[model samples]
Target: MTSQAITPSHGLYREALPKGCIVFSSSEGRAIFREALEAGHMRCYFKMAEQFSTQTELTFCGLTTLVMILNALKVDPGKTWKKPWRWYDDNMLYNCVSMPMIKEIGISFDQFVSLVMLNSLIIKSERVDELASIETFRDHVTRLSRQDDHFIALSYSRKSLGQTGDGHFSPVGGYHPDRDLVLVMDTARFKYPPHWVPLTAIWEAMKPVDETTGKSFQTEIRIKRTQYFK
Candidate 1:
């Protein structure tokens, strides 16, 4: 687990966003969510394993995002579960079920809230329509990230984010008001590195229906209690 700073590069943008990327001013990203970017939160890691033994090199974006957010909030599942990430991922796989059904699908927004509730953490979440304007989405994320004890997780489309996937999940460490960009701490470190992306791109990605529930993905805000584990 390590913390690495990322600088904007033309090659990265060209590869990720061939259609052209939005560039924000330096001052725009200054007021980042410091707590979320702390070394502890940024370094938390999880990988999906096969049969709880061998590494499968599979995707567990939603579970990894949840672990990242919980770590950011200082909530240690390790206090309760021996192997926290794997435990949580297995729970999601078994608990999250839709009528149509897909095996080992990502957890939904509601399931995410339920999991946090089970941990006794204070949580508030809302669905962000994919069709909503970029400004509206930006305002929601900015306002939430600015609050003390608040950290955000989003489920969005990788295609919209210049990646090769349908949907993905990650924690939003900060928002750049001036540039309309958000600092996404991508949990799929095996594939994507942390980076700044346009709020609009995220909005478009989040609009699609999650195959598991037939509902649009969501942005969630979780508040940690100071004495939660006491």
Candidate 2:
């Protein structure tokens, strides 16, 4: 999601009930709200905007920070805690995001994660060659293809996945059909962090046929985040 300018009507006042009453009515609350909003909790940003009722107070610096944070929240399945932390545990929402138009902001990771999370596909990059047994991972994707209904792979690095234990995980790009298990290895081990991650699903693309007209229209798929990962 991309970040966009938010008006008082759209930010705090947009809510049905009074917001930031506890956080912005007093001088101290206002200070806390300012800090929290800059900290980039999606809700806090909107609440601050709501409290001030003026978008002008939101400087470009604050807006940019919020945009990056919100954009990160939209993508990054691992950030959302969709990655398997263990065999038995269930998936959890990664971070909270409240900014409108936050999705429109261009984020490399968001773009990558969105395709995977929304498509029920796991993307692996060729740049993962730094890992000792990356071929095993590639083999895993290929094997998954046998069962996946739809999948995609790219040859270049749109972005790096950071470094892993062995070397930097260069982005190559590959996806699995209907699976959240991405097998690419990175030098950097991105673990579960405290935040919210939107649960995008591929089922949204499903459509049904119209019996009378003999035609079909796209159906909206709205599966809760926990359903697929759990």
Candidate 3:
């Protein structure tokens, strides 16, 4: 009989995990991650991923704005489309963050985001212009939980993250006393589903920062996961 290698526990796995590596224990955690992503928790998801991965700080305005756009669009992420999703340079940090990596891999930012978003097994909507507010989106998504949905399982390698910022927008994937970083992939170029580390999941202590120099910001959010109905 052949013996299977045993996987280590979270503590051992986490300590030995290389920087940027992601690990998940429970199917429930994975499911929630996917659902939160499809529901427009883009920034939140990224923050979570950062706990396990190395990351650079970004402006809050850009992050929050992206979330707002996604909330307004109200689209399904799982559905594939022929046309590329549209996002302005002013709103995204991809150029500043991923350009070096792309050059190393020989690709453009457009191509990178397109590839990542396309390869993502889970995605929300590209256009979310109808939602009245982030709070409204949150409320609306809360209602979506009662309905049936479906989702896919996909995983990828861990990676270091880079981000561009003008300091005018909300921060994404930044350090917070309440949150732990994890790898949350933005499969869509669209700004919805602020997916990242959930502060509440792996709780941390909070510290105060100078108001003028504080590197933190806030936005309203809503998340939904795919559901399977028999």
Candidate 4:
């Protein structure tokens, strides 16, 4: 589910860390980060951390993740953000669709990939629904996280992760092979922190169907690079 921020005044929603997860800001999360770094599994985490940004809108999680990957890869936005600096902004992520539409409906996995590609980033995507086995999903996340030029990101159901929203997107910071957990740098910084999650649980999280597109939450392991396609 969503890490939907709860208001102390409303008392209608609350954020809870169910078993099988730990936020990065916590002591347990700190240990996981320390160990992952010592093991050389955090090659891309540093770069991604340089570009971390929170989602401006509740449904802007996909776009929020998109800009992080883009800037982390150092892709030129082809337009100036301030006066002379070229950059990627959440508002600048509407080449494939209108920002108003995306703001209203968010984006599907396919739409996310399309937006990434349209902005000149090259990504290698895997269809989670068509994945042959959970082991392969584990392998993809494991292998990608070790490389310095690649980072893993995916969209999965909140319910599967024992959260309360809908589908969400975030980058996988690192993996602890021994503990079999993956780091999820959540875009909803207000709701959740960068958290470590069991690998199998993350795979299961992506298996749920998205009713909007009538497809599974198709996830991807992407290469971070700026490409000028001919």
- Against the true structure, candidate 4 reaches a TM-score of 0.90
The whole-model C-alpha lDDT of candidate 4 against the native structure comes to: 0.82
Per-model TM-score versus the true fold: 0.62, 0.20, 0.23, 0.90
TM-score winner among the candidates?
4
Candidate 1 lDDT at 226 equals 55
Instruction: Encode model 2's per-residue lDDT on 138-166: one tens digit a residue.
Output: 34434432322222222112112111111
Model 1 bad stretches (over 4 Å): 1-57, 76-103, 130-136, 220-230
Candidate 1 at 66: error in angstroms? 1.3
Assess each prediction's global lDDT (C-alpha) against the native.
Answer: 0.54, 0.25, 0.30, 0.82
Instruction: Give residue 209's lDDT in candidate 3 (0 to 100).
Output: 20
Which predicted model would earn the best lDDT?
4
Candidate 2: C-alpha lDDT: 0.25
Ordered by lDDT, highest first, the candidates read: 4, 1, 3, 2
Question: What's the CA error at residue 134 for candidate 4, in Å?
Answer: 2.1
lDDT of 3 by residue, 36-153 (tens): 4555443343323332221222222233333332332333444333357543222243433464543233332123234324322233322123322444433332333223232111
Candidate 3 local Cα displacement, residue 67, angstroms: 8.6
Cα shift from native, residue 99, model 3 (Å): 21
- Candidate 4 Cα misplacement greater than 4 A, ranges: 1-14, 226-230
- Expressed as tens digits, the lDDT of each residue in 1-230 for candidate 4 is 77987558754433767788897889888988899888878887888899999999988999999889888877888888998888988988887788889889998888888887787667877767553578877777778778857767888898898887878999888888889989888999887778889988988888888889888876655756745211
**lDDT of candidate 1 over 10-92, digit per residue (tens):** 54332343242322223323333333344233221121111112112234565566654554455545443454342333333
Of 1 and 4, the candidate ranking higher by TM-score:
4
In angstroms, how far off is 31's CA in candidate 3? Answer: 3.7
Q: Cα RMSD (Å) between model 1 and the true structure? A: 9.6
